[model samples]
Target: MNSATPLLEVEGLRKSFAGVHAVDNMSFSVAHNTITGVIGPNGSGKSTTIDCISGFQRPNAGRIRLDGRDITRLTPQKIAKAGLIRTFQTVHIYEAMTLRENLLQAARPFQASGWVADFLRLPGMRREVDAAMVRADELVDMIGLRKYYDAPTRILSYGQKKLVALAAGLMPKPRLLVLDEPVAGVNPTRIREIEEVILNLHAAGESFIIVEHNVEFVMRLCERVIVFVGGSKMTEGDPKSVQQDARVLEAYLGIPA
Candidate 1:
């Protein structure tokens, strides 16, 4: 791939926790409008690398560039404002709120002033609330959760909750969406539905980096796969080629190639 313009680039990324290098000297570039899969065994630093890139965690050493702008030390909120967002493996939806309200809350803009202006129900606040509702509705439809929009999120199944969590992440309109085990614990029926929604979003001009332990499912959705082992990059290539690489298998299985 040409190096002139990449949507995202990481170089020499490293992170350590309790004397263990969770991520070590990893480097990769993601082209614009591409779906890249990140696969590795549990504790292989897959989530750590993503956290560093998305600003949930800072790397001990590395460079994170988006559209050629360095953002290594940016805060999570800053990263989101800059169009990078991530969804965790664990769900974060509000149990008491309806799916629509949850999405609406996520859609609201970041505001420093609190309580006083909101309590008064100012015109600007009302307008923002209305806009949030509209955006929430659109996202609900896109995620195929329109029927459950007004329902309490507590009543949704595990897979449905996962979908709603993903939709909530998109409410901020990120340029790159990083997902961590998006389909983990999901039922077989909803797995295909999730894939379809993700693919449709990709087709509509979104880039993604999916971190998953389920290699086969990721291979089906991603054009290229990057493998990590012992907190460093092992290999990366098209799914077919990467899967056939003896080194990749060794990395996943803890054996020599």
Candidate 2:
């Protein structure tokens, strides 16, 4: 890929369920090593757009490119293997597993060997598992979950679970991480923690596309913001300009700019 090429691009994207259009003629791009925010009113197709981009839902018409290669028709698993991973609004962690175990499972997808080696516990497989454990511990420490490393995920608070999910998404070292509402229901402190994690990751050269309803949070976190209304892009710009746009304020915040 060229240095100037976008990390991810969506062109003329469209999706519909039954007769209702969810994402209509949407288009955007996420640059490398940048945090881009997507915000809109309810039913404005924010989630739908993400689903299409991440391969959770197939678009009726559009082109999706990752690192300059077409990935519009790839399966979710294939797309993930291609270094694009996403996390949902609901934290999806193994309730009965420890944080370390959860992180290990997330790393399983990137394992070079097949399950046959893992099942047999071969020397190479054991070495791989050990290395994965070390990586998991590093991730746990990075996300500030080292204190609960051995605790069952069920015992952690909701916000902590969100952190675990975020860390899990990073386990594969994806080029782009699509986060769906990273701090939707967390407390203020946890929200700040999540924000800090995002900023830290961005600083470390990870790219992100954040879909959030928290306008203030988006303003504080994202460099570029895209506003959606009626299943299409209303406007896009820097955080300040997007927030100050009359169309964005009216369509997204239900207030005049």
Candidate 3:
């Protein structure tokens, strides 16, 4: 792709369930190495948009492209392999596993070992396992979970589990990371930590598309914001401009601009 190409593009996207449109003619583009936020009221199709982009729900019409490659028909696993990773609003950690183990599992998709070799513990498999472990350790430290590295995920607080989920999404070093409600249910202190992690990652050349309800958090973190209302694009701009938009204010706060 050329330097001018967007990292991700959703054009004329539409999805409906049981004759009700969830995402209707939505279109947006996320630039490379930038953080973009999507926000709207409940039932406005925010989650549905994420689901379509991530390949969890196939769109009935429209196209999705990553790095200029059409991916609308791809499966979720294929899309992930093509360098888009996403996290859900709910934490998806394995409660029985240690923090380190959870990270290792996250890295498994990128590991080079075949199942047969892994079952036999061949030399190559051992090396792959070692590499995965090193990566897990690094991620543990990066997300401030080093203290809980050996502890079961079930023992961590809700906020800590969110951090773990974020770390897992980073394991593949995706070109675009889609975060859905990343700060939901997290404590104030953990929220700050999550913010720091996002900033640090973006500084390190990562791109993100965040779907969140915390307007203030979105304003503070995202370089661009997209507003959705009733399953379609309402307005989009930098944080200040979007916040100042009359339609956005009316939609979000029910106040006239």
Candidate 4:
């Protein structure tokens, strides 16, 4: 690894569910302004590793760092505020809310006031709400959802739902985005659209660590690839090199390389 610190780093991470080790001693780092792909078979600990990094699940052992600060034990919301955001394999949006409303909710700052702000409707609250809407619209346009900005999210198609998920992830203007299967089960037409959005986001100085099973998608989008097998690091490198590695072939059930 280089001497410069990576935007996000995982070291010696270990986690288990009911005695099965989902992620065992895993370690990797994502550098600034770079796309790193994480690929593994079903149950190869790809999602489990993301869970630990995003603070959704606590690891039994390991260290996680963001910009050299240890965030191993922080809450998910706190981690997000620190500029590390994660997306789910399944899009989670407010079905009853309009696309604008859902995006506005994401733009709101973490309220130190919490329920107090809601109860009292403190001064300047309305202004803050307005600002959030403005930001929300800008993001909605950027994610190509402007046409449905006022439409209820429940009425959107699966591909549109995925687009909303990407919009929501960008609400906070995160430094690092952890995408969990951004293109899964979608038709080929929509897959291209999602891929374009991801590339545009990357071009705009946002780093990403994407967990995907689509080998072609992963190979094309990632500058570097990390392969995991049986919950541990198998091999990692540039696209052509990593693809030809013997261990990588064995891990993914490919013919001997």
The CA lDDT at 197 in model 2 is: 83
TM-score list, all predictions: 0.91, 0.96, 0.96, 0.91
Expressed as tens digits, the lDDT of each residue in 1-257 for candidate 4 is 24398888889999999999999999888788999999998899998888888899999999999989899989898899888889999988899999998887876754343567757887667667777777787777777788898999999998789888888888878888888998887778888877787888789887888888898999999999999998988888998998888888877975665
**Which ten residues in a row are the worst by lDDT in model 2?**
248-257
lDDT of 2 by residue, 150-240 (tens): 9899999988999999999998889999999998998998898888888988898989999998889999999999888999888899999
Model 4 residue 104 lDDT score: 77
List ranges where model 1 is wrong by over 4 Å.
Answer: 1-3, 110-120, 254-257
lDDT of 2 at 250: 82
Give all candidates' CA lDDT scores.
0.86, 0.90, 0.90, 0.86
Better of 2 and 4 by TM-score: 2
Clashes of each: 0, 0, 0, 0
**Candidate with the larger TM-score of 1 and 4:** 4
- lDDT computed for candidate 1: 0.86
Which residue runs does candidate 2 get wrong by more than 4 Å? none
Rank order by TM-score, top first? 3, 2, 4, 1
lDDT score, candidate 2, position 13: 95
